[model samples]
Target: MKRYRQFEPVLISGFKILEWTHPEHNHNHYEFIFIREGTGRHIVNGHSFPYKAGSIFLLGPDDQHYFEIEQLTHFVYLKFTDAYLCRNSSGSTSAIQQLEYLIKSRETHQMGFQLVGEDNAIITLIFDTLLLLRKDQIVNQELIWFQLFTVVHVLQRNMPELRSNSFKSRDLQAMFCYIHKNIYDPNRLRI
Candidate 1:
């Protein structure tokens, strides 16, 4: 019910050392949250899940969430909007659109991905590098955009495969595939 709306296109990335407190809230912008350290539970849209260091959660505008921080935590959030993604005609519109669809279609209001195993090292490295640039007030917009895009792509690629518990028939599978394939064209999807 609470919506945090920002009109301007922006990319905000930062690290926060926090107390055991997080407000329950929702936003108009998209959020990619990475837990740098500590332990807690993240509750989104009534779904509760435990979280620890390396936990990552992606949220769209429709989700409402908050955290029960059990310990002192370090949080990193990459907040952006579609306007930000399209701020420049970098020929990335289609890719961003796909990423948006992926984010929306995947698990909602829960841990989208965990920065574990090989992902731990790679994501940490990228996070650290980006944090440094941010701290220094670097003006490398292109680099920042690309790095954040990479992070989104990683999350999308790591998302769990959709489970079709309702439709077990091969016809359902074909129908689902066809729907996805024609998602971009309204006329094709209608037919």
Candidate 2:
């Protein structure tokens, strides 16, 4: 298991042209991948799924994956960590905790989203905004947060099970405390 870590509290965004250069990899952070214009088969833990323009996939920590590109693909990736999600928390049910449940409970092999019709248009609009914002090196943290939340929320709306309100408050509180207290302590992190 490769544990790629992000030290800073910021969303990592990029556009890549696929040439089958990178091997299958899994990391410690959460990944939101959008296929901007491409045709490909996404391989997750040996299972294959077809993907095209507007395809969205969420890779949580430990979701091993790689892509088999069929057409020259333009892939966009948005990566972040729980620490970043928790940075602006104000209450018990925060984005980090919502994301914790969303990420940890999902099947590693599941493709997170499929775009269609109006949904496709709307998400693509948001995707374009995020790409533009990243390109300009803008410091609009609130917009970044909202955009990421919209992505996650859209995925949840598509998957009914993901929309379940099952996280208990005490658990979120405890998890928040544990994460904040030991974020810089690797030894404590190991526990």
Candidate 3:
């Protein structure tokens, strides 16, 4: 029932766990979690599923989840605030819009990623690359931005329902994001 808060735009950290430290919880930001090694049941939004190594999943601000570790689990979390997405949006608006589309459409992506074989390897590689880029405090913002987009690109290619042709138009996605962010402001919501 608790919701965690994150002030930073992006953070990458990993740890091994015998059991989850928190109870069922959601976050103020979004989280992209990779199960580097382990076996467990991921109880997400009341839906439970088994996960092992290479189990990748995403959780938006409103999604509630917790892990039931059946064996020792190593979790690498790539957490980012919505502000991260907004700030990271360079000139290419479509990609960010598409990602926002996925984030808002809970039924489409809340369960996370069910990847395997080469796909698993590729994602692991991307995350590993990100881990390295994030260390030593010499982080290249552009490079990190690109790699994060790559992860989103990979997710876009794999989620059949979110095929490029089927994605909401760029302007529509933008409007939705705009509206969602300014929901409390009547002036901002006005056309």
Q: How close is each model in CA RMSD to the real structure? A: 8.9, 14.0, 12.2
TM-score of each: 0.75, 0.74, 0.79
Show where candidate 3 strays beyond 4 Å. Answer: 162-191
lDDT of 1 at 5: 87
Error of 1 at 75 (Å): 0.3
**lDDT string, candidate 1, 48-154, tens digits:** 88988888888888888888888877877777787887675478876686577667674734655675688777777777766766653347667767778777666
Q: State which candidate has the highest TM-score.
A: 3
Error of 3 at 97 (Å): 1.9
lDDT of each: 0.73, 0.73, 0.81
Model 1 segments beyond 4 Å from truth? 17-22, 136-138, 162-191
lDDT of residue 186 for candidate 3: 98
The CA lDDT at 140 in model 1 is 64
Which has the higher lDDT value, candidate number 2 or candidate number 3?
A: 3
Separately for all candidates shown, the number of backbone clashes (residues 3 or more apart, or on different chains) is 0, 0, 0
Q: Return the lDDT, model 2, position 53.
A: 90
Local error of candidate 1 at 191, Å?
A: 37
